[model samples]
Structures are given as C-alpha cells and as structure tokens.
Target: MRGLSLKMLKKITNPVLLRSDLLMVVLNRDSHWILVVLDLKAKQICIFDSIKNPAHKDVVFKLVEVLYQESESFQSFAISEWPVIYVELLPRQSSSSDCGVFVMKYMERLLDISDGEWSWRQYLNWQVEMNVFRAQIAYDIIKFGEQFAKEPAKDTKFCNI
Candidate 1:
C-alpha cells in the first residue's frame, strides 16, 4: 500500500468501518485535531479530514513529536499540507494497544504543563527536531483579548495578534 498519492488520501474520511484492528491517532492543527486511521492488517495509513476542539497546542505538538520520534519508519511518512498528519499500520508484530500508549503519552505531557513550572524554556530544541514552529506564542499572548477594530484609521494595517 505504499506509493499512495496525496490525492487518494483526500477522500478517505469515512468512519473507517472495516477493521476492529484499527489504531486511531488524533493530532492537532493549532486548534483542531485530525484523526488518522491505521489499518493494522494492510500496513497502510489513512488520514481523516476532521476538525475538533481547540485546546493547548504545545501539549498536542509534544505528543506528535514523541510518537514520530519513536516510530522506526516515521521519517518516510508524507505530509505536504500545513496541517497534514501521518498514519500507518501498527507494525505487523506489534499489539494495537500501543496506539493507546501513544495517545496516553500526550495526555501525560499536557498534565505536566499545568504543573506551573513558571519557567518558559524555548521549545526550540524539540520544535526544531520535530519541525514545528511556535512563532505565534508571543503574538498570541500579547493580542489575546482585544476587540477587533472594525475600521482602523487609513494607512494603518491592524494586526490582532
């Protein structure tokens, strides 16, 4: 099932009715989550086009990084679009339970963030390795609550964030 085109994947958001041996992975896109289906028997990956609740991006990003980092063939997965996600069969000999383990890792990471370290380390090292950028944090914080001005005075391009 390799060499599948990006075009073919775009139409696969169906409820994944075929297999009980499936592994579902939901990763974030700044705000919403995309569900990825792994067909354990076929060794193929299917990403669903779905959007979900907005929560903490940092924690979600961390989860994705750790999962990809540990997967042996992870580097070969294709992700061209800004919010594209990767899915693949749970390696043939492995148990589908590992998928739950992978998701739990993210939940643990989120709990850690809420502990209030009060120290913000540049997420750069992990970000660089995982290829994700947190460039919007400073802006997101600074402009988080102001009302959108309907009409800014001429000659001024107002940026909310």
Candidate 2:
C-alpha cells in the first residue's frame, strides 16, 4: 500500500455490473476491476445515471447484459433476503416483461433520495461525506476560476488562436 496506514475496502463477492456503455466501478482497496466488452476503448470509474434507468443506457448501449444466479440459485429466495442476491441489470429501463435485476451480496445499499430519515448505515455515511464535500467544492471553484481570470492589458496585442 505504498506506505500503508491501515487502509480499507475489499471483499468483492463476484463481479460484473454493466450498462452505461459499460463502466461503473466502486470496488476499493487500492482498486483494480476493469471489464469492457465490445470496445469503447477503456478507462474506468464512469457513472452516468441520467436520472433514470441509468437513463435507458443513453438509448440502448448495445442490448445490455447482466443476470446471474445459480449459486444454489439463492435457496429459492426470501430467506430474509439473506446474503441478498437476486441479479438484474439487464434489458435496460428494466422490466417490461419484468426481470427485476439484482446482484447483491454484501451490499452498501443505494437508491437514495435525500435519505428521508437516514438509516441505511446512516444513508451510507451521508453518501460518502457528500461526495467528498462536492469534490472539494468543485476543486475550489476550478481553483478560483483559474486564479481569477481577467488578464489582457499588459500592452494588449496577444493573438494566437
């Protein structure tokens, strides 16, 4: 860990959660979990949930795929949603004919809407500290708008575009 200090995050119970043109990662512990099929080049940590159905995959990102079960097929469900895993993330905008996708195991519950009364681990610790305090106030407003952009008089005449 480059200089460890008791870091956290680990224990991925089976992976794969595509759609959004594939790229949605959040497995920590000095991370590494890339999976891109049908090439869109490849980088990572891309999450664009356009207000819904991962916003219908920005209009069908190639017929999506995600539906796994079979590990004892979850003992026919309802065991208090035990070690929960029902699998679903398929066929976009979900369920016209219904498949209610799920792939939970040790979930960190999602689907939050301003956490009505907070309790899913205190709404996941205020959604991870309000997304690291809104990404440090959007990097201090883009470093104070590039150190206060307003320069053009040192003798003018500076064109190069």
Candidate 3:
C-alpha cells in the first residue's frame, strides 16, 4: 500500500503531518520492527534494517511510493522522484529480537549527529551500549518532558517525579 490511508491521517488528532524535516517511520512486518526515514530536505529515503536481506528492498520501495503519495496529498509536495537509499551498513543485531531497539537507537543516533558528521561506522557497538542509553533516556524524560521543554507554563501540568 502506498503511503498511509487518508483515513489514518484523519484519525490522528491534531495531526503533525508535513513539517519541513525528516520523517521517521517504524513499522512492524511479521512482528519485526524496522526503521525508514524520509529526508525531504535531502530528497532521499533511508532505510535502516538491522537484519540485512534482499527482501527489504521491496519494503523500501513500497515505503518510498507511499511517502511520495502522502507528501503530495498532505502538503502539496511531490517527492516521487526522491531516491531511496538502502542503508545496509548499519549495526546488525546479534539476536533475533533486537530489531525494535535497533531501530530506535538508529533514530536516536541519526538525530543526534550534526550536519557533516553522519557516519554509520560511528554508531557501532550500539547493541552493547543500549542499556546505558535506555536508562539515560528514561532519566531525561523524567526530568523534562518532550524535547526537554524547560519550565512548564502556567496552567500546564507536569508529573512530579
């Protein structure tokens, strides 16, 4: 199926659809989660699969088609010509069940890197470092909500932690 159904967008309350930035998607195929990022600014779609396989090319293409359609429909932007780059050089999971975690970590590191600092090699050993990063994320969230928004505004409530 190409892009998400229009009904899907309607069901999403206060839909944050088309910001001028990379859009990340995490999808489950047969209970295995994988990551796909649409870089609108770069005109590229990057797929990060922890388990490398030829079948993932089909998944990537489908996602590209879907995103291209959705982008036009949602924001009047056409991304049909954007190239899809299969990132097969990511840190492969040693276990069968770490796909979701791998996707999340991939996203985290991707977002953390600055312009001109991106390299798949730098993110190696992520599986081994996952526990520490997980705890750190938990701590950061408990300290500050949603991108570390400091000082809740008057009439806004925050959970006491």
Top TM-score: which candidate number? 3
- Pairs clashing within candidate 2: 52-55, 87-102, 88-101, 88-102
RMSD in Å for candidate 3, one decimal?
A: 5.9
Per-prediction TM-score = 0.24, 0.22, 0.69
**Over 4 Å off in model 1, which ranges?**
1-20, 51-68, 71-161
Candidate 1 lDDT tens digits, 40-91: 4354544532222233334435433543444333333321212423323211
- How far residue 131's Cα lies from its native spot in candidate 2, in Å, is 6.7
Question: Could you give me the TM-score of model 2 versus the true structure?
Answer: 0.22
Error of 3 at 124 (Å): 1.1
What is the lDDT, from 0 to 100, of the residue 16 in candidate 1? 35
Tell how far residue 2 is off in model 3, in angstroms. Answer: 10
Better of 1 and 3 by lDDT: 3
Clashing pairs in 3: 3-66
- Per-residue alpha-carbon lDDT of candidate 2 for residues 1-161, written as tens digits (9 for 90 to 100): 11121111111112321222222232211122111122122322222221123333322222121111222221222222222111233112232221111112111233232553313333222332444645666787788787667643455322211
